[model samples]
Target: MQDRTILRTPLCDMLGCELPVLLAGMGGVARWELAAAVAQAGGFAMLGMVREDPALIEAEVTALRAATDRRFAVNLIPAATDPLLLDAQIGRCLDLGVDTFTFFWDVIPAVVRRIKQAGGLVLHQVGSAGAARMAEEAGADVLIAQGVEAGGHVHGRSGAFALAETLLAEAGVPVVVSGGISTGRGLAAALAAGAQGVQCGTAFLATAESFAHDYHKARVVAARGEETVLTDVFVLNWPMGAAVRVIGNSVTQGLGNRLLGHDPARLPREVIAEDGGTALMRFSTDSPMRHTTGNLEAMALYAGQGVGAIRDIVPAAQRLHLMADEAAACLARAAGSRA
Candidate 1:
């Protein structure tokens, strides 16, 4: 638990856990079972708590609290300026009594200050050196360098390689590299490229405990190269100009055709109630809920190039355990000799 192994990255030290692995905070796809399983597996799993109803988050976290006595994290989306919803999420999470939290999207100093003052550990997520610098100044315990290759909404133009290298060269805090990590080779590669640890998303998306819809899960299984496109088709439904990468389908692919290139914020926004409904079911274990179902043709299929690496559906614990085991052995054997 305390050696110079790949798992002993700064994340392990920051979270006070044994392993440096963190599960993807895929909303809807991120479920209670998966989070708990990861924590139980000796790594940390983050609960994606961006758009769900206040009650749903409360229920899930309450269950998570009962399940794992180990260290875990709750991820929040802050790109939008939804005061009511954001406050509700912070309130619920605080009520659940979680210690560590990962803040996604814009850097809100007040949230960071408030959380710190309240004794909660906040890890600010950013996409560029500018973002990372802002997070460090904001007092983030850790900075997650989420590259363009990562799933969900990306806030930085900097790729994983450059952002990570740049951050490590100057930043004072620990930098965890996220986006497109799948193979043990990827983990080895990221570390060799100057990352303290790698955060895996697409790999865990194929797991069993994930609440992603059956149809959505199948799409992940059936996807091929270049199926993904970056647009605000769905994000247009959001309040701001949030650009997310997803598989280009009918409703989604047409967004680009609809315009010759314009501002995303200019597009129409979806009703919060409907948008909330869609997100909740997109990752339902049994069936695709609102978020997963309605967007099927052009749904937000947030994925990375690592999609090709996912071969089978397995349990959450087994997934993290296997990745750790593989990364360790892979690093050891690779480090042994290059000849």
Candidate 2:
């Protein structure tokens, strides 16, 4: 396989595309427009189907279907509180004739079966190699190794680099790497580590199509290496999983004090819903007004170390194009040295 001309992947062949690189599904951020842009640009993109209403998803899916007749997937970040919501979302998406689905949170076997019945592909995300193997055994066609350096809630994994390397030989499925992957160089490194492609999140969130608030996009563009903090900081205000990454905010700042055996449940009750209402999601240009409010220092501002790779706000199409081009160049360089 290494000797083959680095072209579209088995996946791209499956999707009939020209590139293997994908835009990682950013919750709330992977809107229809952005998803279409990436797929149209020849990379598979996925819709972040967390916490979105059925009507909203329908409209977006319809729009995407019209925008570009390319293959893209939809993500369902499983959580308990709104597990039913996921069922509903999946039904609606399948109704829209969507065949590609990605599973996160906890994988649902029934859903996987349903997708397979529809002739769709299932890509599962994992934090470690063992989990990747499990996903493969569970009928997943691909494994996304998410490292600790990734943004959003670290629901599945703890170490990105280790997970990537571990999956190299152990995973029977085609492997993709996520977490802190923000550039063409990172893409090259991931492929060198035995990845078939790369999934980038923070890098996409900084693009012009990203629905992040003006301030949020600016923050990403202006971020330095140490600007991000990973902890259960947003967990207090939100009922999200125990692990998450966000800009160091008051909730995280107070974690040390609360860590000394003081029950966070004993602490004050200022926040309301803890379910998916406040879960960390990527911002999209088409997001509801709820996401537009620049309520920094409180809301979830998920980012990654790759924020430094972002400098300017460009179109999503342009961004995916450049990443693919750079990845091709990098792969060519590696292939040339093999002889």
Candidate 3:
């Protein structure tokens, strides 16, 4: 069973899902289990397929297919190295029957052409209206306007709703607002402002199927609106420039700009490992995984402003259903008010 009440939007119809809510393709966090759970719950789920091994990516996709027949998207992080790596990944994904994709960072013309040729739907995550226009011209099917308040590596300085408003007026394709959005009220506000849907990342981090560590999840649950800091303090995993929003940990509080002085830490170095032996970076773009060892408390706890509203870890389906029902009721009340 999907959402008990269907709240239809262009995003839901375009994605063939019952609700307009989409699980942001969080690297390492949105694994097969979480993605499958969200998809099964009537929300469109996306797997972060950017930095995974080829075999592992294929295996994850196969596992998700085995779990649910629902269509989900794979998010690609463009590589600066050999284009062959990305081509191989895309080919493997197409072979596995995946049709939708989301791209972050720069837009690769060849990739856009290839996916379009294969009849795949392309959604681009852009921080600004300029990038949105560029992706639309490059044949992107949807645009995710991510605001600065979003967790992880957020690109733009503008807020999500503000970015969405500009994109909706000009981007031409469907626009989904991301960042600082977790509640039905947020969803209604996005829709009321002309957005097609909302892409939630931090909210799903508290779900039972999420791979986030208990300690990390607890931090998110306890976080207030002012507790998160968007900084470049954690730079062990990715490049040095990107700014990510994280809960104020000791590491973030003590080290102001020290990450700028340190080089990106080498992965597979056995610094930290989450439950089930999943290795994590010293300051990972992904959140802390379960049963993690080695400086767990000091490690980066990625979350968004919406963490204020998250209280407990629940099933992803139940969260989606409740949010959908709430959004439906909110929209109904809003319409009646205008009447």
Candidate of highest lDDT: 3
- Cα lDDT of model 1 by residue, 201-228, tens digit: 7777777887775656667666753676
- lDDT for every model? 0.70, 0.70, 0.82
Off by over 4 Å in 2: 1-7, 156-158, 236-241, 256-291
Ranking under TM-score, best-scoring first? 3, 1, 2
lDDT assessment of candidate 1 = 0.70
| Candidate 2 lDDT, 1-339, residue by residue in tens | 122236466656765567667777776788887788788877788887666787888988888888988888888765532767777888898888888888875556666777777778898887766667667776888888888788776655466767777787687778888888777778777767767887888887877776556666776778874777766534543343456666655555666544223333544544422233543332211222224433354566778877778898888878777776676688888778996
Candidate 3 residue-wise lDDT at 328: 78
- Looking at model 3, which ten-residue stretch has the lowest summed lDDT? 259-268
lDDT (10s digit) by residue, model 3, range 236-282: 55665667888888867776655334445432244554545666655
Higher TM-score: candidate 2 or 3?
3
- The number of the candidate with the highest TM-score is 3
Clashing pairs for model 1 are 211-283, 212-283, 278-290, 278-291, 279-291, 281-289, 282-292, 295-299
For candidate 3, report its TM-score: 0.91
